[model samples]
Target: MSKITRIKGFADYFPPESEAFTFMENAARDVFSRYGYRELRTPVLEKTELFARSIGEETDVVKKEMYTFPDRKDRSLTLRPEATAGVMRSYIESGLATREPYSKLFTFGPMFRYERPQKGRMRQFHQINAECLGLTEPAVDAEVVAMLWQFLSSIRIPNLSLEINTLGCRECRPAYNEALKAYLDSVPEDGWCEDCLRRKSTNPLRVLDCKVPGCKALVDDAPALVDSVCEECSDHFGQVLAHLDAIEIPYTVNKRLVRGLDYYNRTTFEVTSGEIGSQSAVAGGGRYDGLIRDLGGPDQPGIGFACGMERLLLLLPEEEAPRPDAYLAILDEAGMARGFLILQAMRARGVIAEMSPTPKSVKAMMRQANRLRSRFCLLMGPDEIARDVVQVKNLDSGDQNDFSVTSESDLDALADFLR
Candidate 1:
């Protein structure tokens, strides 16, 4: 038998890393709230059709990356590859679409994708996703993007760049696909991967998302959707740009931008960082005009974005989240018992408390607490318990204070001594 380790492409965040991620999540949640977006939580697993219908069958996510499996009942289910589809499922199921014209919603949780292990990409990752349920206006799209920018700024993430574009509405999408396919067809099929060849038949635009060396060269001179956008799409995209400009949100027109999901209809954009490799996209979103009707809801337009927590952390300064300032050290069986009691009492009074299950020794616990950089050590022993007292030592000042132990009473004297 072999000792178990984490599967490739999956990661376990240790304490310090987990702390920093929590900070990032809290800031994202707070900023989402300020923008009038309330939270929505859904299950990590959903019916397989949810994603198969929402994310295009031709896309990488649906074709290869999704973690799908079966249950005891033999019904197929999948660990969500992303949030939008599941969120949409919740919206439709709850009948929230009929009550509100625009229901702003946000969700954060783990999303699973079965991709090869690599930098930036992972098998399991966390996303802070936000969705705007019913606004058809391009201003709504810009506002979401603005909120995303503000969130990154709030956390001091450096070198953020916004790449915006329009992928055309369903009414006019066929023509653009025709043109894109015409361009794709001009290139020899032998020069591309098998998936790209299949994409040529079902989803030609995904070839643009490919990093294949041969396909890259083939599409280098291909026609862009921006040049092919229909009149209504052109107007919609212009208004989105105008709204972004009016709000003074800096962005660049990336005519080549296209989302892997089939749901994106217009005004697609991705916020990227220069330093991160392969996973350069920190956040991305777009309009899904026909999605409501597609999901059997009344015709509702929507827009939103999802940010990767791990990738966002990469953009921040190297300084980690704040660690605990004090560790209450306990030694010996009697001292361990006393420490547990003290921890309960101190925690009730709003102190971050830590204690080992079994007391090692006074000197050992002191060293452990000091390595943790605890501000002070609360030392107790059989002798101290006998006198109904414990020693409070300030590691920094090398000063010690003694206090009687009791179930009720202010430890003001000990507090004053430490100070």
Candidate 2:
């Protein structure tokens, strides 16, 4: 009777799209490791309180966007809205303080936040998070930002602009909040979002995250967090800027740019690009120097950032993605079995090859190969098997050759051709 349908704000990453995700993951992993960061993985399902405490109770993620449910033991659990909390939970629980100042750690996986589906934001999203714990120097901030820039360059995502801000330390924020709230409270009541109205009381800083034009215009004269940074924080922010300039990476200080999390403190930054509109935020992260100890660790200082994989994938240029070099097509029933064996051989030998299990007409298979844009197609038919060889066709140039299938030596030739 009723047609089955997927839920709102959920999506599947098909094979073609997976290419970009994988490239981004690999690029991030390489960069983090090069910086001496290790990998730390935590469960996708975390205690509900972890995020509630870290992101803040009034934040959208905790107030309305988290995907939380009862576990088998009736304990509250949540599909992680973000990965940093899980990492914090692990560091404290696993006694990582013993490895104090753990540098350059990374995790790449899915993140869930049940918010309105927009251009870049998603209910079920993915992130390539790189965290460097136990470091608070502004130089650390520069390194983290540099790594992000290098990652985007590696993936050929263009036009990345950097916007950074200092949320100030605990001391500076209170005064700034008072000023910001005063400005917002002065605005006509009709201009603010219902959520902003709530924030005006609970977490006044988030009023800036609102998209309402009238609300934004009203806060235009609001106190800037950067200008209000305490002397020490101002120095740290200045040092981070100096490091960026020393390394030739340009940035702009946007005082109103508060990362939508309560734990984020000092040196917050975002990378944006035109390729992914409206959701153009390709990456963002900041120093959460206090989160480790707050989560239960022994007062360890750390700073790190996490980049959104889905957003980066959306922004990546087409030719930059890594794609399969070959699609092996089997033309008849007998060829299907042999084709699978060849597929195994190609993969074992490091060939970027693909395959279709079912046999199809030569015309249909050829069309499929072309549609996939495979550089080469290896076609094996009963006729070729009798000759104890396979037909290797280069789709790029329409060149054809025959090779014996009896040895690894023969497959090496195919692999080389695909290369």
The numbered model that scores best in TM-score is 1
Q: For candidate 1, lDDT tens digit of each residue in 101-156?
A: 67999998999998786666688989999999888888888889999999999988
Off by over 4 Å in 2: 1-3, 188-190, 320-347, 352-387, 391-402, 405-419
Runs in model 1 with CA error above 4 Å? 329-338, 356-362, 381-390, 400-409, 412-419
What C-alpha lDDT do the candidate models reach, one value each? 0.83, 0.83
| lDDT for residue 232 in candidate 1, whole number 0-100 | 89
Taking all chains together, each candidate's TM-score versus the true structure is 0.90, 0.87
Q: Assess candidate 1 and give its TM-score to the true structure.
A: 0.90
- Structural RMSD, model 2: 3.2
lDDT of 2 by residue, 116-225 (tens): 88776778888888888777789989999998888888888888899999998777778888887887788888877788889898989888877777777878888888
Q: How far is each candidate from the true structure, as Cα RMSD in Å? A: 2.7, 3.2
True lDDT of residue 353, candidate 2: 84
Model 1 accuracy (lDDT, Cα): 0.83
